[model samples]
Target: MLKIFQDLRELPKEEQKRSNIRNIIAGFILIITLLIIMGFTTLGGVNTFFETLRHYSETGELLISLDRARLYEQTFEKENSLNSADKAQQSIDQSIKLANTWNTNKNPP
Candidate 1:
């Protein structure tokens, strides 16, 4: 092993430069992986979940902004509106009500 390292030390300038870059890149990748592992372990899964949720909320807000802009462009007017998820929730609530009604009638209690 010592002889092999000694042979590597005597390599040409370009090869030595490549070796240094290879070592640097490998070390950088390893350090990044270790940091990520430490972060996830220290934050815990629940904390990660909440952090992910926070990111999702930000994305949702961006989507809502785009929708609002599109709506404005189509109408050439501004109007207040609920977010898309709120509209979806309203639809879901209506569907649940209809389902419950059907279930109640079918039972005929």
Candidate 2:
């Protein structure tokens, strides 16, 4: 590298200017390449984070629905009312819907 610079210093003024321009272009290319790689890596990490958050949210909602269904079932057992049975069925349906949504989101085509 030192020998290369020594030869460059010996070149004519116009040749030196061209060499400098080439060096600048090379530097810019290197910087741009690095930036693009970093940008993609950062974007991938962000996408993963959001997907995880969505999964957690769906899981939480599913759990809540299940809990509600359990409570309704217990109520129906105690009182033997048609209304409680219907509510439990509705909660089970909601839980099924959430699970489907979560599955679809987790495995997109």
Top lDDT hit: 2
Model 1, 1-109: lDDT tens digits are 9999887777777687999999999999999999999988987977879867866665555556556545544443333344544554555555556556545644668
Which portions of model 2 show Cα errors greater than 4 Å?
A: 1-21, 100-109
TM-score of 1: 0.32
Question: Once superposed on the true structure, which residue ranges of model 1 sit more than 4 Å away at CA?
Answer: 1-11, 45-109
TM-score computed on alpha carbons, candidate 2: 0.67
The lDDT values for all models are 0.66, 0.92
Candidate 2 weakest ten by summed lDDT: 7-16
lDDT of 1 at 52: 72
